[model samples]
Target: MEYRITDGIVEAIIESHGAELKSFKLLKNNEEFMWKADPKFWGRTSPVLFPIVGGLKDGKYIYHGITYEMGQHGIARDNEFKVISHEKNKIVFLFESNEETLKDYPFGFKLYMGYSIENSCLSIEYRVENISHEEMYFSIGAHPAFSTPTSENIEFSDYYLEFEKNETASRFPLEGKNISRNTIKFLENSKKIELEEDTFKDDALIFKNLNSKKISLKCKKNTRVVTMDYSEFEYIAFWNKVGAEFVCLEPWNGIADFVDASGRLEEKDGIIKLEGQEKYKAILKIEIQS
Candidate 1:
């Protein structure tokens, strides 16, 4: 099932499967800000990454003297969620840990994805509740793809990203699917990243502890802008398929396992631990200005 929400100026569509965001658009101009899920490039618009952010070492993890096998980015995005609430401008979807989920992730939990639209902004709220008796270790993140070249005359290189504040941070390079121990100089008190076709030749750029919580996607040829604010997240990344017409801005609460991982779930980097009955919430907002 799919739900729609609007606040006069902007509109959005949410799908029950994975509680994924399907569309975001402006009402008057009929302009779309989200990727169209083109199978030729990438088939997903916005996918929710949960239980884990990236790939595990050898695609398995050891938890409490037991080895569990799970794929990259965990199991939330490929499943169905129940629609718990629906309103004109707000909608909520729910996912719970079940018998199948326990086989891969040995924890009981409830995950809710709340989407709300207000004027020109859309907020994606992720709420997690640990229902288990013991401690639970997990991670969550967002993968939202934004369409590029809003006008036919512009090319991908004409687009650029500007941070709300200049950052002096280094990004961790990825060695295959796991995180490498090496650090590459990425930003040096700079605010803008000029986008090009070959920018992602080595895959996505993942950064940690960035000074800016908000980033804007802008094009030199167009006055329109798309900004993302992920204040509570510790990590932010930029990604895209080579030569594709879209870009992804990701905000993550946890990270992937290091290359020399200990194989223990609790020992993973940036792992979030929650006590029984505890709740965790993360908000990611996308604003569009014409």
Candidate 2:
């Protein structure tokens, strides 16, 4: 099922499958700011990553002496979510652990994804609760893809991502989808990165420590801009398919396994641990201007 909400200035469409945001558009000009999910490039607009983010070392992990098999980004994106609440400009979806999930995750939990629109900004919030008797370990992240250029006259290369503050962060390149130990200087005292076709040749640019929590996408010839604020997130990622017309700004509270992982979920890098009856929350705000 799909739900829609509009706040005079912006309208959004969210589906129940992943409780994912399928579309975000400006009401004044009827211009879409979200990706169209082109299968030729990418087929998702915004997907919720839970229990895990990115790929495991070998598509497997160990928990409490038992080996579990899980694919990249976990199963949240493919699972169904229940609509818990809906308002004129806000909606909330809930996903609870079941028998099938226990086979791979072995934990009882509830994930709530909420979307709200106010004026020109859209807010995406996630709340995870541990329902199991024992402590639960997991990861959660956001993958929201926005259309590049925003205007047909502007080329993708003319666009760039501007950070709120100057940063000198290192990029951890991926090794066949798995996290690698090698690090390279990505942003050296620069606040913006010009978009290029080869930017994602080696997969997503994962940054562990960044000085900025907000980033804006801008084009040289276009006045349209999109800003993403993820103050509560611990890590950030940028990615796009080669020659694709969209880019993803990801805010992650947890990351994937290392190339040389210990195979234990508890020991995985950037994993979140929650005791019984505990909850965790994160927020991502996206603002569009033209």
Candidate 3:
């Protein structure tokens, strides 16, 4: 089912499947800030990446000496969630491990996702609880696609990403579906990155240890903006389909497997290890400007 929330300034739609955000719009002009999920370019608007952020080596991983096959971004986005709570401006959805999930992921877990709207900003919160006797290993991230060039006259190249602070970071390049060991300098000392069609010719740009927790998508031809604040995440990724009209701003607590990975789930880069009865939480905030 779909739930609607509004704070008089902005309106949003939260869906039960994957507990995903389906739409975000400005009330003043009824202009949509979220992507329309154009299948010609990309079919998903916003998906929750859990258990794994990216792809594993050969779409398989080893856990306790046993091999398990799982697809990219895990099973969360494809599974249905139960509504835990609901209000006019807030909603929460819950997902728990089942026999189906245990086939690929042996550990039992409870995942809670909440969406709340306040004024012009939307806050998304994720909570994971380990419910098994053994230690649980996993990763979680957000994939939110926002429309570029809020104005019709502005071209894709006219938009740019402005970081809250100057960054001297490295971009972890991807080889096929796995992450490569080599990295190249990304931002240098600049605070802004101009967008272009060829910018993602390689793949998504993954960054670690960035100086800023907030970034804004802006256009030179218009005053509208989309800002994302991810203070709790350890890594951030930027991606888009070539020639697509939208960009995904991802904030992750874990990442994909390395090309030379040991096949062990716990050994994957950025994997979170949680003991029995332990819980972890993270938040991502997005604000739309008109």
Candidate 4:
């Protein structure tokens, strides 16, 4: 089912299945942006990461001396979440590992996601519990794609990212996909790039070793803006298609390697493990201004 929660400053639409956040509308000083969720293209505020974020070496991972097959971005993002509790400004959604998930994850676990709106910020909290007798492992993240320039009529090329600091980002070169091993050019100044669908002609620009926590998307004219402070997350991703008005500012706890990885889960970045009956949590918050 779909549910709505609000605290006057912000409003959120959450789906119980998969604990997905369908919409996050920032009510700015008495006006709403009217965020919408398309039933056909509905995606979690950001897709959830679990047993794996991307494909393991050949779609298999080495665990306990055995190999298991997994797909891209795990399965939790599309699953249905159960509404466990709610109040005026907070809502909690839960998902328990089941027989179906076992086919892909092969682990016993419980995932609880909470969405809270207070004033102008939205706080996302994630809790994962190991339900098996032995230890279990996983990864978590947020993928909220916010509308850039805070206006619909503007072209994607009109948007520019403003970093809190003058720090430059480092790009990780992708291999094993017929793509060459070369680092992508990082944006230093406020530059503009035209958006073209089917472009991205190359692979995704992977970034590692970042130290900044805040980034903003604004018009080249600097009239409209939306910002995100992800100081808590280990990394951030900036991506959009050619002509995509929306920009996806992703905050991740981990990332997947090229398809031809060495089939070692431990070697993967940001992989976490929990002892029997233990739990882990990660939180991300977003503040928007118009």
Candidate 5:
């Protein structure tokens, strides 16, 4: 792991595998931002194609004429990436498919990720290039866990997503290999409950029709807040491990299973496709304050 710092921002490139974020900078109004990525703080991961939030059938997805092996969230997460460029307040990392990937994913592809800091905003950009003659399909997202204190004396229910508007959102549910059209509405209509063990009680909040580019998190004391924005994503997912203290607000170019489809990658809902030999791109931005 190595880091590059400039203009109050620190960008880390993990040369060991997939050149993940390693650590993201948190800049304040009058000071330089800090990067706390010692595994105990924050480590970055790029969840590819199917950011599988749960178990999938045999770690495989059936495509055109055969079945393909894909890890829980695809291969990008675990690959060693190279730092291609670094300058100013931004850094670019690149990851490409190899012999091992070809065995599972037959397409030739290139993924270039960039992290840029401008003032108080941190923007993440992902560019996917199709190198083969066939169309390429995949989903990409960021999984960055912000720090929280357990001794804060605030219950999980003390926090709620504060949308700019009172308009509520809806989401379909998923049951181990099955999709249920049963929907979960947001805001009070979805039932506000405490964060408990084994509770995703309402399933991941799925909002596909977003009129705004940002979403914010508000705590009971109104002390902590984090906002994320994405212009290219059509879906936003909010999730966490049953008892984990961290909440992941994910902006996705594609989504997981819809209530009525087989667990197939190419067939999964919200898939990103690149025309043969073309390129696809998307961005996610986060701003945190306390």
Candidate 6:
């Protein structure tokens, strides 16, 4: 099922399955700021990554000497979530660990995803509660694709991502499903990344060390812009299928396994170990100007 929240100025559509965001738009002009999920290009608009942000080494991880197999981004995105609340301008969806999840994750937990809008800024929250008696290790992240060039007169190349602060970050290029230890100089004391089809030719640009906590999608042809403040996230990435008209701003608390990584879960990169009954939260705020 799907639910909607509106603050008169804007509205968002969320669904129970995966707790994924289906749409976000301005009510006045009925203008959509999110990418339309087109199967030809990509089938997801906005999907939350949980338990793990990326892929595992050798398609599995070792936990306490036991091996478990998990695919990319974990199982939360494909699981069904329960609607916890749906008030005007605010909504929360809940996904608790189930018997099926334990087969791959081997832990008991609850994930809460909340979305709210006040004026033009949208607040997104991800909360994870460790229900297992033992210390639980996990990771979480966000993947939201926004439409670029909001007008027909402009092309995708006319848009760029402007960071809040100048950055000297290199991208860890993907080696198949895992991260390659090798790095490529992407931004060196620069703040803007020109959006083009070649930007994603080697897959998503993943950055672990960044000086900026926020970025804005802008174009030279118009005033329409989408800004995202991902202060709580440690790693950030930008990705899109080649030839697609949208771009994804991914904020991740953890990254995929490195090429020579140990298969242990606790040793995984950016793994979060939560004490029993403890809760962890990550938030991202988005402001849209159109």
- Model 2 accuracy (lDDT, Cα): 0.91
Return whichever of 2 and 5 wins on TM-score.
2
Best by lDDT: 1
lDDT of 3 by residue, 175-232 (tens): 9988998998888898898899889999899999799999998888887899999999
Which order, best to worst by lDDT? Answer: 1, 3, 2, 6, 4, 5
In the range 1-290, model 2's lDDT, one tens digit per residue, is 99999898899999999989998988899989888899998999899999899999889999989999999899999999999999999999999999999999999999999999986789998999999779999999999999984355667889899999999989888888688888888888999999988988888999976889899988888788999998999899999988888999999988878788998999999999999999998889999988
What TM-score would every model get versus the actual structure? 0.98, 0.98, 0.98, 0.84, 0.80, 0.97
Per-residue lDDT for 106 in model 1?
97
The runs of at least 3 residues in candidate 4 whose Cα sits more than 4 Å from the true structure, single-residue gaps closed, are 28-45, 149-153, 173-182, 185-203
Off by over 4 Å in 6: 149-152
> What local lDDT does model 1 show for residue 267?
94
Candidate 2 pairs with clashing backbones: none
For residues 93-160, what per-residue lDDT tens digits would candidate 4 score against the true structure? 88899989877677899998998988767788888899888877787767666654335655555666
Local distance difference test, per candidate?
Answer: 0.92, 0.91, 0.91, 0.66, 0.62, 0.89
- Model 4 lDDT vs. the true structure? 0.66
Q: Single out the weakest 10-residue window by summed lDDT for candidate 5.
A: 29-38
- For 124-187, candidate 6 gives per-residue lDDT tens digits of 9999999978899999999999987435678888999999999988889999989998899889
User: Which residue segments of model 3 deviate by more than 4 Å?
Assistant: 149-152
Q: Over all chains combined, what TM-score does candidate 2 have? A: 0.98
TM-score of 4: 0.84
Q: Please write out the lDDT profile of model 5 over residues 204-250, one tens digit for every residue.
A: 65667666667776667646777778667877666655444655666
RMSD versus native structure for model 4? 3.5
